[model samples]
Target: NVYYADFDKILLEVCVGKNRLKTERTDIYTNIRHFGRTTKKGYSFKAVIPVDKINGRDKIYFEYTYGEAKVRTSITFLSFQSRLSNKLPESYWIFGNSILSYDEKKKQMIVEPLTFGSHLKHEIKMMYRVARHGRKRIGKKKTLEMLRLRASIKLNRGFGRKDNDSISGAPKNKKPVWITYDQLFKGGDNGQYFYEYMNKNVSDIETCYIINKDTKEYKELTRKYDRKTVLPFSTYKTRLKCLKSDMLFATRIDIRLYMGFTENDEIYVRDLFKADVVCLQHGLTIQKIAQYQNKFYDNTKHYFCVSPKEVENITKPIYGYTNDMITLTGAPRYDGLVGEPKKQILITPTWRRNVTAGTNEKGKQHEYSVNFKRTTYYQIYNSLINDKRLIAAAKKTGYRIVYLVHPILSPQADDFDKNDFVDIVPGVKANYEKMLKESALMVTDYSGIQFDFAYMRRPLVYFHPAELPPQYAEEDTGFGPICRTNDELIDELIKAMQSDCRLEDSYKDNINNFFPYDDQSACKRVYEAALKITNFS
Candidate 1:
């Protein structure tokens, strides 16, 4: 029997001595109740072989008939008697570039990946479409009690188990530290700086970077740091390193890194390894962000706080951080923001949670509504950038509008007008320090980059299209000139640019009270803290 990825048109053909004989459809497979339905989850087709009637010269074929195109591949059938005759190894029956295995617990045949998309490169990546196409919730409905039972069963799987040395092959060192960026992609903020500090500056410690296999940094880091260890994301080896290392550092709270597999996985790892988790925060805290709510777990021992007010107002009270766990190290990303300003006005706005709230026919989640132009937030922000008043103001003032969009809306940036006066900066390609330094004024709304601009003594104009969300409204955003209407935003931009973008007195006060470090020693302090082991348990 063979299993392929999900497709509507699949047939199994049996050939005896080069003569066309019989064809089988997988939908009729009912030896197992879930066989017909498993194809929706990327496992398609099953072939029942009549091996007794076939000779050594006979062949079996699988055909995928899609639209007008037919893709056919054949494999020579060795024999079915290998299991009964005991003359051949388990590798006798291999098909379609995949290993066939049976799941004893599920009572079904299991193909390792169940998909061929994993083998393709980036240019021809079709795995995402195949897995997500025609996806719908399946299986029998269950009551709340049944769901609870399943959860309890999963929680109790490896509870209180003895330490397993499955991942104990990590290098022998006095201090082993693991560092990673958000989602294990690449470093941009404090995570980047600290990873570099330990990877290059510190010689006594062993540094390992956790990276997603698809990330560009994965190959680069692996090639550069040949002497040190580099763990690929979502592997047992990486999980073991997280569990055994003296400390773990990352940009955000990733619960999957600790207890994703089982509830006791975190307990076993934290207790056995005494691994302290440090959060080198991605940005400054101003609003009541959802990601920061009750983020501290048992193993989360230290948080790199940027300011005292952030700890006093947001981090300590709302985010559940104690004074001992808070380390007031100004963000290392800001160390590069100290430079001259160019005649460029940057327009950056926060993302609306509701804009990306619709679903497609296949029940797959997608952001950006078809009626996005109707939303007040979209209309106001979009109109402002393309507004003749703002563009003309920039042209007359001898300034260019360098629009640095949020990474979420980056792909759609070109959807707006592209004039010589307005340049759309790609978020990934742009050098953050140089862009920030070149911009004389920042036009924003509740984005942390506003703070970055204010900290650098550049003028900022807050443009609020409608009544701000209560979570963001409640927080103080310093003393930048705010614009509630389109006209007001335009007036403020022209006024700031005309006056050469001077910093307001109240903004200076906010800056003085916000960041603790002014000597550019943030990286040094964060690197020093990375070496110490804090046992939160």
Candidate 2:
């Protein structure tokens, strides 16, 4: 049902059309019903417009007629084939490093929310959308139509097989190298750093990054670098490049999940030609609290080593990988870590699994509220942020704290009170890295960024409330003072500032143990490795 504001007397009629052809098509729709009443602000109604089929058109148009005024809108239809097609853009949230695991009991993927706010927001929205859909005509038929559409499309595509028969051919550029990050493309990660290094330093190797189309990152990349250096992720050109490329560098193999391609698709393509793959990991793997397993490590030829411990852990007997697959080339993302330290604190916390809220089955809007303030995270952080002791300590130390909320909590920035004492900074992924570079100290609870800060030889303080969710145990953090209460955190901060923010002796030892190289030659090492990997082909 459509709503009109402050309606007096208006004769309105709604009609459906196929493309530009307008008519009251009886075959396309059936049992049209309307239910609503007039309110002070407007006249609202629910018109149950159920369409049996789209009849092969890309979209159906709706015409709203009201007294010499005609408004138009169109609803696009997706056959199941189109749903899994490479034409659609992937969802943005998955790249935030949230884990999705298949639950056998529930028969659905368990999604953990990124922050307290997202957890609450999802819960609220799920309920609201479920109830709203019950009262709408579009609600009931939508799920059935979607399933039917999917089935119809799958039948046409020969079901669960590659549609790349048209793409089969010999290599276009035999020596081409391909690069990409996870589906969610961000800035200044290992992927971009590697691409930049290859373009400026390495020679005689054609390189291109797999980028999503119509994305701001894509536009920015094209504006900053050569437009021809990027290939659209889901297009024929990308598949051709992947098939023919001699070497592949990527942050993750999760692109398959995003593109609706299976492991078998990759295997089928791999059978044609062996493309040596190098994995430049996006972040340091914290095994204890890591939600997702390294499922793709076995598939790759080389894995970039961020630390000695990472290499050791991944090559354990259970992981089934040997040292032969490990390359001690440090992550390219860490090559340019130069910055003058400022009196600032960066707070980056890990996400939680228990706090995740699932959406309704029919995919309707949900409206509900979770007491975000009462959450364990809020209870601990809010106390420290608003505490007079911390404020006084901050003033004495001449330092300001910036709460770099996780990307998942992006929408819930308002959940915290904005004031001079604490700044809740949440914006672009690129800016987050920039902030890290400028910070003198980092306060976090089990985030991989700890490794990055430690690499800079800066002081770090870990504040974990006992009541909050369990991250990795305290022992897992080899260096850094662990503070459970606000008072402890304040005392630690003041002491660290008085010492001129030098990283402790233990931290130095840990840094040395983790990173074998601190000479800023990571990109060089990576390029040399790439040359060795491609020499055979």
Candidate 3:
């Protein structure tokens, strides 16, 4: 169970091949081989799964093994080629742009992307007129229906349908991929509210994080990165190109995402809204608004803000905003805070804002580096490296730090090379459970993790570094224990380390409209939300 995720979100592999030489075909499974683990006589070939699997300390045990007289997992790199090509259909891609048809006789389906854009791309009247007067060449309604249905299937885990049976025959090992936006530490009322909203609205007790692509990895120049992350699959143009190529060996695509970002500007979202339901984790951040410059959103509808209590004190009522709409649903994560917390302290630092670990020297910035601007990361890093009192206090008090870097930061830094001070990590969803299980001491600067950390009723410490950017003008600093110095901060931290200030009459009853489920039903909440979105069926 890996808590901190790296650039590769997941690494999963499946093994598929016939038992006899008569079934000698080799390109049986998808994904390129990474490494071969074991071998038994000559009965089987052990192929490394293609996706990254995150369990670090505990290796995943398949629990059971299939027919095996021998295993052949070892392979030479000089020539590592998977030849499961002949039996499968080429190009399993079914996207916004693809020509498709089902061949009932052969029980095969063919998809050709780029030959035609999506039927929805045309005006409704033009599309209808084209459909009525001319030959149906292939689709408009049928293709869109299937694509939407595929997304729905992935969302509800196929809701009682036999996903294994395709127009073509069932392949051996096939699993659908489910992905969603991560909102644990996005901060502001939106992030907190959405965190709780997801916990209460979504189901399946799952958590997945996707790192930005700009963060790259390099094997050359010691500290240098090549264009590998961007070269093969970077932009949408490149992604489409790669898809056209991935088509050669693909069997079928279970589901593809427009991904976690729920921008109304997206062609897919705009098309789906009339007939589809959507659940979002965070409302628009200030950066997003500035980036869009009033052009990114449509005035017709607004994003539903689920975590309102987190921002109610500072933000005005957002439920009825005009240009950009927001619904105040109250987050599901904070439901536990309804009465009072046994103890609570949240220490989370903001991610790099203007500067990063490695960057070109043109004074250019990623712009998304919010934390980098408010607090100097390298300085805090130095403080953590040199401070003995802080370290000793953490150790003596049986304190455990819940370090959550920006999800976008991992791609820029290596998990193998991440700071070594972090201690104790339970599985994913259980991170909040970990906070509930252990000490409540939070020490952070400018990071949104502090917002939820406040939801806990324990001591809080804010590390406002000297390097904070002046451009970020805001008067509503969070109300709790705050600090500016090293030694002085430690004493304050020690004082608040074991306190319960969340139950005070001042805030217990005054609730914001944002957060939806403060109780432990976050998973159920999320599952229900997914159901609502998928009811388009």
Candidate 4:
């Protein structure tokens, strides 16, 4: 007998020598019953063969097929117990050279095939389970174990250091310290802008920033402030400051950014840390993200939002946040968006999971598929940028086109063909605020950056080459004209250029309804909300 498992179905084959046998006996027991039809295609089939006909020369194959579209899949077996009427085998077994383990929660045997690299095999298998069953079903213990495993993986990837240090170096009798950062290795987002605002307007609280000392952003920051204000990331001193701080602010709530890189470091920060966490989001909430659910942010004290609609989205049953937990304070980076407009068109598209090869524990894509140039995302943008009509129109209208690749897709920046009419910029080096202020028109596909351009009363064109996830499929994105083809996007670009990128009144009304504040006081509001949350006002 041979067994095989695929993404949608399972197959079992019984053979005698070179001949195959078929039977109508469909009753077979496996641990899959514990899931109770978790998959869409839950039905199974089997064939029975006489045991006397089987021989040692006959071969049986037990295989698991993984699809490129699906990141993870698994097969499991179970040992016989009184709970199952003692009809099954007493010992667990696997036929292939795969990682085998026991799932105590479901009382089943788990097997993970070594089809990919072995850098973080166990951790990757755990991620597959979390994706399949979700965090709530997996319980808190498994989730914490996953975090710890992820932390060790990240340390090997140079995201942090493995150092032991004390908090004795921290300031002893200074004011309450508040640490802020956008990314562990980068800056220039809501976190940086809010930290700047805190330093300029308020003096009661001490502000510090954590950034990678090896980055260009760090060199730029050091020229403005002393070392105490700009602490190096993943170092003992930074960890000390984080431990001594009273409050922590960030655009992302990742534990790796605030805690040391080790197995138990994330558990310590999440369960034992005393500092209050305030999430200054990098972008407005425009889609349903599974990671943003309530259980993932158990330590977050305040969640700053951009509008009432965003607040409503967070308070939904899926997100599980209460009204009191949210604050309707606009993004801090919006306060610094002040500059003259130029006749330039910015085309920025978000990354897709299907096209990316894999991401690190911090949700940063460090690799891209070898066939990335063959993906639809690449073909569409590549064709649009190189279109003869679009290139001629930009040249004739005295307009420049800039393509900004999302940071996660930066490794493939060279995949697209370059021409004189268009300039390609990597997201890591892009001056986001500068581009937002200078660009007169913006073209995007499901990027939250569209709101930033809309805040400037500029025109926007959306390109939809693929269907969005189910959560965002029903979202009403009527703030701009959505284009479905390369020709349609080119036509919209020419039309916007003809009118000097003036936003339509209907879209203007949409933008107005989306954002309640544009008075450059969002940083102040966010600061006040943080002070209130920490009871430091």
- Give each model's clash number: 2, 10, 53, 0
lDDT of 2 by residue, 382-402 (tens): 666777866777788888878
Candidate 1: how many backbone clashes? 2
lDDT of model 1 at position 180: 50
lDDT for predicted candidate 3 compared with the true structure: 0.33
Tens-place lDDT per residue, model 1, 1-537, is: 345443445443433445444453322211222532333222223345554544433433444455666655533322121111111112211232322322233322333321333222210222222122213211122222223332333233222212321222122234545555543444355665566656777766666766556656667767777424666765665655554465666566554442222321221122123345577767765554533433433335677777786777544343555677777777877767777888889988776665545432111123445565656666666677788988888888899898776655454555566777888875544567788888888888777777667667677888776654432444556757778888998888888878877887888777666666665678777776654533211
Report, for every candidate in turn, its global Cα lDDT versus the true structure.
0.54, 0.54, 0.33, 0.64
Alpha-carbon deviation at 489 in model 2, angstroms = 1.6
TM-score to true structure, per model: 0.61, 0.62, 0.41, 0.67
Misplaced by over 4 Å in model 2 are: 1-172, 182-185, 212-216, 258-274, 286-298, 356-374, 427-430, 470-475
Clashing pairs in 1: 356-367, 356-368
Pick the lDDT winner. 4
Best by TM-score: 4
Residue pairs with backbone overlap in model 4: none
Ranking of models by TM-score: 4, 2, 1, 3
Full candidate order by lDDT, most accurate first: 4, 2, 1, 3
